[model samples]
Target chain A: MKRNSLHRLLSTCAAMLWASFATAEVTLNIGYLAVEQPRAAVLSNLDPIPDDDGLAGARTALQDNLVTGRFLGHGYEMTEAVVPEGDDPLATAKALLAATRFLVVDAPAEVLVQIADLPEAQGAMIFNTSSGDVALRDNACRANLFHTSPSDAMRTDALAQVLVQKRWTDLVMIAGTRPQDQAYASALRHSLTKFGLRLSAEKEWAFDADMRRSAAQEIPLFTQELGDYDALIVADELHDFGRYVLYNTWQARPVVGSEGLSAVGWSPVIEQWGAAQLQSRFEEMHGREMTSQDYAAWAALRTLGEAVTRTNASDPQTLRSYILSDEFELAGFKGRPLTFRDWNGQMRQPIAIAHPRALVAQAPLEGFLHQNNELDSLGLDRPESKCEAFE
Target chain B: MIRVATACLMFAQPVLADEIWVTNEKDNTVSVISTETLEVVQTYETGERPRGITFSRDFSRAYICASDSNAVQVMDPATGKILHDLPSGADPEQFVLHPDDRHLYIANEDDAITTVVDTETRKVVAQIDVGIEPEGMAVSPDGRIAITTSETTNMAHWIDTETQQLFANTLVDSRPRHAEFVKDGAELWVSSEIGGTITVFDTETQAEKAKFGFEVQGVHPDRVQPVGFEFAEGDTHAFVALGPSNHVAVVNADTYEVEDYILVGRRVWHMAFNRDRTQLFTTNGVSGDVTVIDVAARKAVKSIKVGRFPWGAAFRPTE
Candidate 1:
């Protein structure tokens, strides 16, 4: 009885120590605000992209992380509030703040600014999912929230880095008229100038879904000439009509922009490195493959999860400070480790360029250099952020 | 490798009194030897490079680990065709059937998952990921516990099958190779390849209980040593195959001591026991022979030259 009691005492202490070291369950909340403006709806649906299903790729990824969290002791729950196509986004956000602590808004940049100004949203984390306007990351930045998707300047720079490395010097530029669309057009020109690529010609076309019937203005300059430029760079952010610009370039050059050879956050054909398991797990959960937007959602939620894991606290103050500080480190299927850019909350990650089915190239493409990780080549860093948040 | 392998086949196939199925690599088949007649019975074809073999609890079904095929082939001891099986993921080197008989845990060498397959369903039910490149595994008598040796990580994962969680990752040798739990579920013994020592760990606390290492030169430091082992009941001893030592080391389970060494053929890889643990067999892959040892005397009674390179030795259940 004496020896048995001693053995029993030892076993109990060991079991309790093991249990305490492993049982921490973290639940991350992601709030989504949707829109249904006729013009925005037309632009989003015109490209044969399914509605209610457009964000399926990203939703699947979030769901996968949520499932992994359940068994692995980390949890994530995403709740949504829609700002129907024409409703006032400010009124919609004000009404939804009661239930949501974190917002993943898919709307225009101006509306995102309005959401940031609201007193109720001061302590909440807002993720700008839809807009790629460079202004949000620069002049109009917010201290409490973050951008999951790449900014317009970042996306254009990714392509520029690749075009410069490949020496595709001459390009035919196209444009769309949305407020952010105009920002992308200027960003593309900035890319050419920054990378020393010469622009052959610039053309403008009304944004339309039927690229084949309405792409006449884009076609004549691109398809008929077969002249000076090596590739066509189309900038149709609202409708992404650049896909039709390729093979239609009169000069017979490949196209790059919102279409062919486009650069973005994530793509389906990416299965190298340690990506296989992540890909397999996502497929197992969502019943389909992933898209670029899905990667942004994954990165956003993953960063928050990392912050919680590192700080070992769920308080908003601890998480916000970790993400804003220069001490953050995380690896989320980007082939390289990524960290927050300190000056801004934008996580520096790689940009994979591809068609719907094939990956044409990955940015930070060999020669593009950076003081830190080469992936910083795809986004704006401290020297260029112009983001005076901490300054 | 060719000539020595051919000579190994001379003593392989014939009707025998004692039934011991030996997986021969060169001949690409398993030779059946009858114990009473001390000769061959028949041969059964298995997957390429079949190395591990164990019977179901009832001793009616035999599961063979096909390292090259990356699967476990289950067959009726009387027949050779793959009647049923499940994916071993990749490069399954060895596996142990738990006492429950409901689950068969496999050690797929190239992967980190220790795949657990249900015998009745023949499907991979759960895969508990462990340290890199898990090679050998064993389950305790109660079926509530199991452990796998992770070669690259140089550790052993003590997992709770009921909870399906890796409860512990206990560090061991530079290349912790294989593990076998002693009866009563009180202790688990692990063999190290590089460290050339057997480390005994407490089952509950997983603390290093004791250690055993050989003393002779070249004998003491065996390269890629302690590949696999066989545990016997009456003697409560374990015969450890010392890979480069070309010998088998006898281990006293309770005291954690290497009591003696029995010299055998070159590159000994695995060991097995007879029905009552009175006889023993060691698969010498390089020498291409099976060394039959008399357990009581602790000596090689006879060394039978078997087909090209025998990989497995399994005994028939005593009726």
Candidate 2:
């Protein structure tokens, strides 16, 4: 009778042990915040933004992280808060920062600055997956902020290097009316100066897309102007009139910048360096091609997951120190081991120069030398940076 | 020079394998180079996009994955003639022969299935469903476990050979292209083409033990992609083919440290060692050549021009 009682006790202890192990799974909460900016309804709808925009990318990345994390006995959960138009994003961010240690933000520059100033955000790690402002990368950098999205300087530098390599030094620059377009135009001007390229002609894209139907006949007249340039560089960040300018150009030159042969953080056409696998996985989960925003968000989460796996720790403090250390390197299948810049929290990666069909090349081209890394040639280098956080 | 002396010593040793075969991926042909003469002995036409070629246990027949043809061609190793074709599922990229010399594990990339085929009967015994884009296949030295690296899934799946059931799937890195079991199934190594690292996992614990990265100055870090791995005797040393970096890294398998980087031709994909492990041959895709290396000396000895886009190489024993 005593032996029988002992067997029952042993079985109960085993069951309790299994239950304890099941509940030992660690869960990581990733917070995301983005502002809803409805694109202007234009007549020329070339590449329209999805309803889920940047959130879809984060979702895809969360799915990928979970796949890898499952083997490591880790579980990932993302809490996404999309602020409505004109709503206070900083307020929403504050509430999210209360719960999650890791956050991915797609807010504007001003709102990002506001969120970075919050005392509650001191311990949280924020990944800027949207903004391309060069100021955010330099003067306005935050100790907590990590830019996963390529800066404006990186994008324009990538295009400029490719153009210089192809001997397309003469550029016909066209600027749109949007503020973002003007910012991109300024970055391109700096890139042109850095690469020793000449701006052959400068034109303003005054043609509104809504006027396309009534002013359809005026399209050819607008493009027939004289410009002896090797390529047409268009800064149409609002998706205004770039795609329409492709076949309607006066000269038979290649179109570059935001549309044709453009530089991007991630392109769906990139199949090299095992990007096909990432593309297929995104397609399988979201049933859509991965956009640049999706790739940025995915990269941010992958950085976190890599740190956690390497350190074998889930604590935010431990992960942050490990990530900032020189020992931390995450391979995002970009053909190199991606590391975060110590001067600024920007993740150093190769900018893919691609078209709609295939990858043309990568930035920091051959002969573009840097004392430390070739990727630093794309954006604000150590000496040029004013980010006091790392200093 | 030290490299020249090692080359001379390698030549002085009697060559165990008389011929070496390279699969010309784009040209649909196999280039046979004689070890004694070190020259292309013959060329034979193959099916579309021939890749991942291997010989049978007795070296009588060569099994080549005619990927575009969606079949595995069984060819005469002596003459490089196609004797017959085995029923491999769609898009067979890589395959491995069982140590028992009967079953062949063929990775059907498009189908996401690892088809186990009986070589004698030429029939698929089992189709084990795995992750997407299954590219690499490796059977444990003990013949107990079969591993398939699914590229899109970035996982190395372990399937029990007896049960033919998947037991565990270990995520390595982005776009894992190859899986190799070293140290007699004690260590499992998977190469990530995009991640540019070789992740080693413990076979028993099924835990990632260590990762090795390569660095070649002047070569972009992304181009230092680890692909095929060849082990020397005693599993003490290993050579990893770094794709497009134009280099092969000699790694101390025991310490997991990269000892040396030997420069080779452009886009070196796969390699093969002679029977005595005295020499190594690497197929360079972009340069359209095969680089011969002295294994002991750890240097690229010679480069021989071959067909366009050579993919894989295998050593054939003497007749």
Candidate 3:
């Protein structure tokens, strides 16, 4: 009888060992690719940019995914690669892609396209977290590339909707000298035309003087020629002169577009629809306010995490297919389920129209109807994009 | 004498009918509706942005989740006066009373933690870390299991009440706003608001048993967001509040199929059943009204206007 008891104990030990193996944790490795660039000097020093703008959001999302992942016997590890200025970002992206097929990229449109075209990135899913260029979601779209950042068109459309709702039909445009500013200006022009708003006058900002010191004197005179308009649209994408243009405008009208009251992917001012919880969590982690880039990066990583949790697999191909499928819906704290546009791989979400202090409204605003999804009204709809990669 | 006669009439009927307490989120007040008269009898003040409201097992006290205030207020239901505050973690969005009658599981949305407060002692027994933006809270009938559904994490975390630790976590649809343990704790049903689906999990195995979505004939799919749900007396049917769709979906619990959709006011948030489960009162947030549903007829019989942004509803017995 003693020998029989010993055998039973040995069998129980074996069973326990097998059970542990059965429940062994599955670890997923995610890659974060950030391409450093020279940011434009801001006119105001009150709100300085953080060193870890997009990266902090990805880190927080990693922690969030682990909270849900731990209960499912899953673990996640993030690999980061910050490509310095003038360096070949494609090389870093290639290396990271070799290590992990899932990458949250904070890079420009050109670099994003380069990485997506790499042979090594065939099945890999690349999330663009920083680029807002409209062409990336239009003519230059890639099959594997998904954008969390709102396209320039989306932002402009959001602002246009607000203008239409407020009946601010006549607007003047001020285009900056920078390429990004000019791009935004063109997008603003397109949106103004689309929404039936008239551009009363348009002018390019020619002054190279320091806006911080001379904005009050230079802006009024610079904008004096534009004449009277309901609102002044400034396309200073780098925040260079937007702050100064807000109050110093020639006319006592609302200043919008890239400053004053602007359309954003996410903002700290947004507190409704359970966004306060997200903002608090982010502030607790990184002692600063969450910005638009941070929100984009967070959404990118969370998208992968959601797909992984649902599909029960970490393979890039499986996650990509699942993320693109009808089953995938990301609760982005925007009071709506953010879904990717099938034609362009752009995340369809409500853009918040706000100033620095308070949220004015969220677009796809009421009465801005669409034949399909209301969010589709803000960006490149299915019929607007030229890229056929998703097909 | 008129007051004396009314007092005598009240004394004649010692056991008054039930009262439906609805929390107005924007108004920061609780409107007490007389079930007998189907009207608001009294409105009591509450803390800022009260989202969740519940009563103790014996109906002696009520707990309100004052989300903006970040504290759970305990009130005397008899007098509608605040008695004390429970040490709820920051941003208590929703909470459930454990079957033991003394423990309250509060889902702190800001902290991503579940704060269990002992009502009698007014002390936090345990603060269990949960997923991000935890909003939904529910406890099993036997008090063995508790569920916290995190809105952002999109997962229903199953907690072991005895140890106060997460034993299992199951993935639900996007933005799970509410969870309920039904059929004597045999199954747990979670409603995903943004995903527009209800996921039911088998408690024994912690496996997803069934998942279903709602559809109204003319409503857009995006508007059909399932938020809060309540099961009928026998647990045979479920009434799910579909946010913004302005309809409540009646589902056959056993079959996991939507039997019908009863159109109500705009942005229906939550519902509470009157005594005997014959009538259900739903709080409509946008319309600032309550749609009363006759359970047997499966139709909305009345719409009573309430305060602005009515969010949560609870039935209080007057006897």
Best by DockQ: 3
> Which lDDT tens digits does candidate 1 get at residues B1-319?
8745643553463222446778875575787765544455567888877777877777678788877677788878856666876677776766888888878888776556788888887788888877555766888878888898865445688889998788877766545667888767788888866556778888989899887776544432323367678787753888998866778888887776778888888777777787778888888887888788888898988777777777777887546
> For every model shown, what is its TM-score relative to the native structure?
0.58, 0.81, 0.89
Candidate 2: which stretches are off by over 4 Å?
A1-24, A46-48, A86-95, A118-120, A208-226, B1-51, B59-95, B104-137, B145-217, B220-223, B232-237, B251-260, B275-278, B294-309
lDDT of 1 by residue, A1-391 (tens): 1222111111101112123234535556555566545655432344544353324544644544442233235555555555555456776676666555677666777888889779988888777766677777787788765787787777888898878877888777777666656788888887777778878877676645555555545576545654677777777765545555656666656778877778877777875423544565566556666656656766666666556545655566778777777556555555444566667667777777777777777776766766666666665677877778745
Judging by lDDT, tell me the better candidate of 1 and 2. Answer: 2
- Give the number of the best model, judged by TM-score: 3
Q: Rank order by DockQ, top first?
A: 3, 2, 1
C-alpha positional error of residue A92 in candidate 2 after TM-score superposition, expressed in Å: 4.3
What tens-digit string does per-residue lDDT give for candidate 3 at B1-319? Answer: 9868865775576348689999999999999887866877778999999989999988999899999898999989988899998999898999999998899999998887999999889899999887888988999999999999998778899899999988887888888999999999999999999989999999999899999998998777887899999999899999999988899999999999999999999999899999999999999998999999999999999999989999999999988
Assess the local accuracy of residue A41 in candidate 1 as a C-alpha lDDT between 0 and 100: 40
Hey, what RMSD does candidate 1 come out at?
A: 14.9
Model 2, span A1-391: residue lDDT tens: 2222111111101112223222426667788787666567554665657776677878766665554555456667777777766566777787788877888888888888889889989878999999999998898999889998999999999889999899998788778878899999999999999889979788887765455454335545665674567898989887777777787777787889987889999989987655766776678777888988888888898788777656667777888888888777665757776888888888898999998988899987887878778998998888888998866
